[model samples]
Every structure is written in C-alpha cells, then in structure tokens.
Target: MIYTEENIEAFNEQARLKFPENKKFFDRLKNKKIKKLDEAFHPVHEEVFDEVDCLKCGNCCKTTSPIFTDIDIDRIAKHLRIRPAQLVKEHLHLDSDHDYVLNVTPCTFLGSDNYCSIYDVRPKACREYPHTDRKNIAGILPLTLENTKVCPAVFEIVEQLKKAGLGNKGGIVE
Candidate 1:
C-alpha cells in the first residue's frame, strides 16, 4: 500500500479488528519456540519495509512514547543545548514502569511533517520501534503483536508471516 494517512488509518482499524486472531497466532508462535525466527523475520522485515515508508505514516510517533533511557536523555539534551534535568522537567514524566516517557503524545519533538525533530539524538526505543529486525525474535512476539496496531509495516509483516505459515512444524505449511 501507499501508506498515506488515510490508508494507514484504515489499516490500523483493521489491525484492531484482527487483534484477537493475531494475538492467538503470536501466542502459538511463542510457545512453539520457532527456530531460526530471525532468519524467518529478517527477510520479510526487509521486504515489507522496502514497500512501507515510515515517514508517510508516523502513527508510532503520533501515538506512542518511547522509553527514554538516561543515555537518551543526556544525548537529546546535549543536542538541544539544554540540561538533562531541564529536559526531564519540561518534557518527560515517569510512567508506571518508572521509565521516562514523553509528557505528551505526538511527541514534543515531532514535526507536523511526521519527521522527528530529534532524530539524530532520539531515544534507543524510538530507533528500535517495532523491534522486528532484532535477534531473538521469538522473545519479542508479544511486543511485535502489540506493534501491529501502531505500525502498518508491522501489520503487513505479521500477515505475511502468517501466510508463510510461521509457526507450522512442517516447513512452510502449504
């Protein structure tokens, strides 16, 4: 898909509708401990991302907050020429998990054009949004399942994985 705002909104709505089924699929995959999960996911991740432009759909930055580690805070503060303490006081709040997150959605640093103002110094979590290309893909199935709602690329990746019979015991259950 083109991943325009309208198209992404529609895809997100469908992702919500399909969440239960996707959740079950993720659960099954998690239990199966599918070997070579990174091998399975990386190629699909590359393929889907080739077609999906995140700049066109900033739903993730628009809706979710990345956890800002101390290193992230320091780097972003340095980039902005501000004190880390000042940055925290002005823009961040501690979440239930005691991680520092943005005080507002759409992110304080996100531009109207869907580009990050602090892209160069953005948090580690922001850099790793969706988390599909990382090693130990099986360990993050739950996180990936949740990301399908926020990222069109992730939703498409999961759909492609399912069609490829990801968790099936006999290779590529066709």
Candidate 2:
C-alpha cells in the first residue's frame, strides 16, 4: 500500500485489527531461541523498505518523538550553531523516562514535505525509527509489534513474516 495519509490511516486500522493475532505470533517468536532471528528479519526488512518510502509518510515523526541522546543534542546543536542547552530549551523537554524528547508533535524539525530539517544531524532514534533491521530481532519483537501501528512498512514486514511461517508453532521454516 502507498504511504500517503489516507493509506496510512487505512493501514493503521488494519494493523489495529490484526494486532491481537500479531501479538500472539510475536509471543511465540520471543519464547523461541531462534539463533537466526536476525537473518530472518533483515532480509524481510530490506524487502519491505524497498517497497515503502518513509519520505511519503511521516506518521512516526508526526505522532511520536525520538529520545534525544546527549550525542544527538551535541551534534544537532553544532549543526545549528547553537548551544546544546539552547537547543534543548527551545525544542525539548525531559520525559518520564528522563530522556530528552521533542516538546511538540509533527516534530519541530519536520517539514511540510515530510523531510527533516536536521536530516543530517537528526537524533539516533530518528535514524532507526522502526528498529526492524537492527540485530537481536527476538529481543525487540515487542517494539516491532508496537511499530506496526505507526509504520506501514513494519506492518507489512510482520505480515510477510507471518506468511513465511516465522512465528508458527512449528517454528521458523527457514
């Protein structure tokens, strides 16, 4: 499916409907000690991303904030020619987790065209928004499950995995 707003909304609805089944599948995946979990996820992640362009859908940036690490703050501040403290004061707030996140939704740096104003110096979490391609795939199944709601690509990836029998009771097929 395309990543436009209407399509994203439809995808969100479909994801919501499928979440319970997906959760069960993810639970099974987590319980298994699959040594090749990353191998399974990495290829599917590449394939799904090949078909879905995030620039066409900024739902994650519009709906969620990435934790801004000190390094991210420093780099972005340097790029913007501002003090780190100044950047934080102008755009960030400490969350319950005590991590710095953007104060506003749609992100202070996200443009109308869904481009990040600080694309080169964006937060590390922004760089890895869906976190699907990272290693230790089993460890992050819960995060991936949650991402399915926010990212159409993630929803598609999970659906593809289901089709591949990755989380079946019979165990991963390949």
Candidate 3:
C-alpha cells in the first residue's frame, strides 16, 4: 500500500494489532539461528521499499528524534550558517542516554511536505533512520521491532519475513 495521511492511521492500527505476534517471533531469536537470516533480510528490505515510499508517510520525522553525532551537529550548523554550539543550544538537548537529540518533535528541519530542510547535510542518524538495511540484521531485531510501529516499510518487511517462513510452526532450521 502507498500509505498516505488518509489511510495511514488505519494501516498503523493494523500494524499495532499484529505487534505482539511479531514481538513473539523476535523473542524466539535468542535461541534461533539468526546469522543465516541476514542474507535473507537485505533483499526483503529492498523489496518492501520498492513499494513503500517514505515521503508519503514521514511518521519517523513526525514522531522520533535521531541521535545527532558531533559530525551531524557541525555539518548541519554549517549548512544553516550557524555555529555548532549555537545550533545545539537552539535546537538540541542531551537525552537521558547522553545522546544529542532534537529538542522538538515534528523536527525543526522537517518541511510541511515531508521534505527535509537540510537534506544534503542531514544527520547521519537521520540518514539511517529505521536501519532496516544495516549489517548484522538479526542483531538489530530489537530496534526493528520498535520501528515497526513508526515505519510502514519496516512493518511490511517483517510481515514479508514471516511469510517467507522465518519462524513458522515448522521452525527456522527447516
């Protein structure tokens, strides 16, 4: 589905309804063989994104903060023609985890149309938001589990994984 404002709410509701089953499948991973699935995950991620357009949803931008590395701070500051410290002072705060994060939601850089104001020099974490295509895919299942609520693409990817027989009653080893 090409998610939009009108239908995304319903779609998110469905994703939420299915969250527990998805969580259970991930919970079993502690003992299940995970390494082999990394090879399976990338192509699945690519395939889901071929149909899911993030610009239409942008729920990640609306809902969460990306960790801002020092490099992200400096690069975005330069792009905005401000000092890094000033940018940090104006827009960011150190979270409980001691990571720099945007002070506001619906991010300051997020345009009304869901484009990023500083797209060319956005934070590295922003660039890697949702992290579906990262290496060691199984190690990040916890992160992916959290993201399924916020990203339709991630939700779709996990559903695809299940359909591809990651952990059916027959089990993954088969």
State which candidate has the highest TM-score: 1
Q: Please report the TM-score between candidate 1 and the true structure.
A: 0.95
* Model 3 residue 146 distance off true place after TM-score fit, in angstroms: 0.2
TM-score of each: 0.95, 0.94, 0.93
Instruction: Work out how many backbone clashes candidate 3 has.
Output: 0
Which numbered prediction scores highest in lDDT against the true structure? Answer: 1
Clashes of each: 0, 0, 0
Q: Model 2 off-target regions past 4 Å?
A: 171-174
Per-candidate Cα lDDT values, in order, are 0.88, 0.87, 0.84
Residue-level lDDT of model 2, residues 57-163, one tens digit each, is 88999999999999999999999999999999999999998999999998999999999999999999988879999988777888899988888888888888888
**What C-alpha lDDT, on a 0 to 100 scale, does residue 28 get in candidate 3?**
67
Off by over 4 Å in 3: 169-174
Residue ranges of candidate 1 with Cα displaced over 4 Å:
171-174
* lDDT of candidate 2 at residue 40, scale 0 to 100: 85
Alpha-carbon RMSD to native, per candidate: 1.6, 1.4, 1.6
